[model samples]
Target: MLKHDYKVRTGNNQYEGFLVDLIKEVANMLNFQYDIYLVHDGKFGSKKADGNWNGMIGELISGNATLALGLLSITSQREEAVDFTKPFMIRYITVLMKVTKSTTSYFEFLNPLHPFVWFCTIGALLFVIIVLYVLERIGNINRTDYPSISFKECFWFVFGSLLHGSTDASPSTLSGRILTASWWFFALILILSYTANLTAFLSVKTINTPIKTVTDLASQTRIKYGTVKSSGTSGFLKNTDIEHFAKMWAQMSEIEPSSMVDTSEVGFKKVKEGNYAFIWDTTVNKYKTIEDCDLMEIGPPFDPQGLGISVPTGATYTEEFSMAILKLNDTGRISEMERKWWVHRNCPDYSNPSTDKTSGLQIENVAGVFFILVGGVAIAAVLCLGDYIAKRILKSVKKEKVHAISPEGDDI
Candidate 1:
């Protein structure tokens, strides 16, 4: 109820907001004068230890006000003390948090895979390299065509093949070739998975948020969170039969300074200060996100309930007020009023973003990695040609010496 639906005090003690406008429209239709005021105790109303109601509900129960015009949630408990008109708005609880920018350092390119995944991949590569090297040595012992491979050459051969590049360390024996073929298959699959995943990381701007649902928040303790003290959210947590909400209540109860705050703005301020999340209505959270780019709604809305104009129980005018609201809705006046107050204003261009296409990875995005592969292939080819040339020169030199010698004397 502390959302923008509350009356905003202005000069001459007048008030404005969605609530103020709503009351005005109701008055014009019913042809009655209504004076707007805020509740003295500044509460949404909850049963205290002494067993008496307080806040706007108390104001109505004590005959201090006729109709509660703010965003009062209609509940069975509140209904016992006060009556509600047909709901003018529907809302639900949600989490609000500071917009933490994901890190964009040069090394962020490594984020496509988790640290554990990378560890396992490197371990597999190392294990395969040792197996291939041992197989080559075994082939040599059997007097096969396989040449003895040094650890340095093995490293280049494995890493270069993993990148889909040529290397001078090609195996000749059947066992060595089979082992190399298996590694090639593994490398192909790993490459395809990495490329498919990396496209999302490189193409779209994404927020690296770990908490995406109430279950996530309930499971974690590093981020402190709480609802407005005596709020419907607090009451819901206390009364909910769900286990996840129960755990959240226990955490909020033991938190330092009591995570329960007095107002939505105060709870929002905690979020702005960092490391704190405000549990409140999504309607209010959405409005705040629009005004401040640093704020965002983390999870989907839950516990849907209607926001209605509240009245004291057995009030004579209850039916009339409900009818007036119904008429306003039918005529689209309510929708018009919502757009008048809810549309984005003064928020910068980036605040209202369009659904732009997420482009795929361009050649320039990975040109450097391609160049590395090309350079390795070039060097390996050159070394292979040099070995072949050196062998041919040695063979020809021996032939020339033999031919130059006389047939009988064998002297050059």
Candidate 2:
């Protein structure tokens, strides 16, 4: 339904225009047709092709296309020009500076209570509150639906579940039953898993690092913290402070004002040059480089947070995309994409990182069995409940029929 041009860097340094391929895939899935134009690779090209939104503004303003795709940083200023989707990738602006001083490490500054972690925590809490309030409202309106549960009760119910609660909401309504049995159960598990992982990330201590926090930058004896001039300098690397670098590397793959110098030899050239700090993203595997620079991540990796495709503000498309994304999450498409393009770069050697974390219980092995047991129990419950209601209705109907047919067969 729309014509668009797009480009991304290939494994080689050369730019590969793949607009047609993306169009084919998305169009087939969306059941629509569109014209795709091959745009220049933004990573290595003219200034216009750079990640900056200004250069591409001309195309959008001139009616060249309806939308532009790629790593277009969507900010409040640029948001006026074109709408952006939620971030498809999460990265942190980091300083690939040398560790000049041995005394100070970057780990001290990154605490668990940092704004990023708090934001996620608060967000989870708010979501729990909103869901509980909504459930409470529905429960209040219908007596047969969760009759005994109040808003406060439901709030604590979700709270306990998020922290560590047994699966007991005391919900009495069919709606509540269906909701918990379907959506909430899976949602809770995912949220908890990510939360746990994040907690572990924050707690990790770097064995040897001098600087700890952003404030300690001035005090950092020998290291110099810097980022790409385009992206914010201090703010990007502030959270990464030495300790969290590895965790950041594990979760993110792309970054703005990326330090990825060149795809050839994995940007090792810049690192080889001394005193020059390259602001690049950390990947799962280290690229062996012949460049003069050694790849030293100054601190923990931080979340740079970039533009993703989302519906316009106040548009239902946003919700639709979010719902679809959730479904994709259920199907593992989102994770698979990350593993393919971002993590492994489509390498077969790259295994599912999440699967490596499983301990006592393997979800894949037990999930089907668990579902079967649950399905049997649910079917049995439904049958028993249906039979009881059916018998009650049948008995009432028979009584009315008998009364109507009494004696002379006159209508009652």
Candidate 3:
């Protein structure tokens, strides 16, 4: 229904090739005819008289394109100028503090109690608690009163659903038995598959390679870390600080090659220098400077964050594109793309990740939670059973006492 013309802007030329490939893929998938407009010098589009901010805004105000995609951040100015698609990739930002900063700086990033860490830890804990709760309820149910059980039994139901077992907890009910038997085949298949995958991924008999931390870089007799120029990284700014310069002046320290290199040259020089680290994203690799450097993220994104696409403000397509992304997410295709692009190569190997490990893990994690709930219910049922047995024994003894009392009364 529409003609596609890409209006792109970027500071780096190395990304041109990757962008071309990406555009081709988009073109193949898009039903509309499209043309590529590469503005090599960080220019917005042809609307820009000189590729400046005023021109870019004027283009959007004038309705130049249907959608604009770039390495742009969703800042207030941009938000005012255009509508953004939900960010597909979350990017983390981090401080480039020297390993020595742990001792020198007041910030306590190492503590596990840090707020971000707490969020992740607490989330995992809650998931476990919820699962255990459901499991406990499911395990305690009797067939006769299955319908009257608490709503928490839904957790048990989901567990049963995943396991391909009957959702009913009533052991004596024929309906429950039939449902259980019907689900068994599916339940066993999911369980065995997950178990095998988990075993394969988690098994590690030897620590052949020593794990390295960001701190280790500073201890080395030679230490150099590379970051993109003008990046938000605070450590890069600190590297140029007067205090560091003063230290060099006082110590009569030898000049490090990294200390001499510029931002453009940092990626090229750091890898050749032993004990040096490069900090750049796989996204930046769309540019050429990182082609030679053996780059590793100093660690998993010191801060995870995201980038997004934008449409001109008030464009009707905004909601349509937003809905499309959501639909992709609901269908699990978004996660599939994420694994294919981000996780598969970048993250440690997950179970069967090469094909569809993300969906599998998500399914397992979900199932694990349900099973935990079932286990909780099972424990509760055992306690209930013990109480039932005790009550029966007590009643029998009471009857004997009553009979003895009646005989004594008759004799009297």
Q: Point to the candidate with the largest lDDT.
A: 1
TM-score of 2: 0.35
> Of the candidates numbered 2 and 3, which has the greater TM-score value?
3
lDDT of 3 at 131: 47
Task: Please name the candidate that would achieve the greatest TM-score relative to the true structure.
Answer: 1
> Please, what are the lDDT tens digits per residue for candidate 1 over residues 35-149?
6767776788887888789899888888898977665788998988899999888988888888665444444456678999899999988998888888888777866445678
Report every candidate's CA lDDT.
0.80, 0.45, 0.45
TM per candidate comes to: 0.62, 0.35, 0.35
Candidates sorted by lDDT, best first: 1, 2, 3
Candidate 2: deviation at residue 116, Å?
50
Query: Candidate 3, residues 35-58: lDDT per residue as tens digits?
Result: 444333333322223534432344
After superposition, candidate 2 runs with Cα above 4 Å error: 1-25, 32-53, 97-225, 232-269, 280-298, 303-306, 310-326, 342-412
**Model 3, position 135: C-alpha lDDT score:** 45
Model 3 score (lDDT)? 0.45
TM-score-best of 1 and 3: 1
Candidates sorted on TM-score, descending: 1, 3, 2
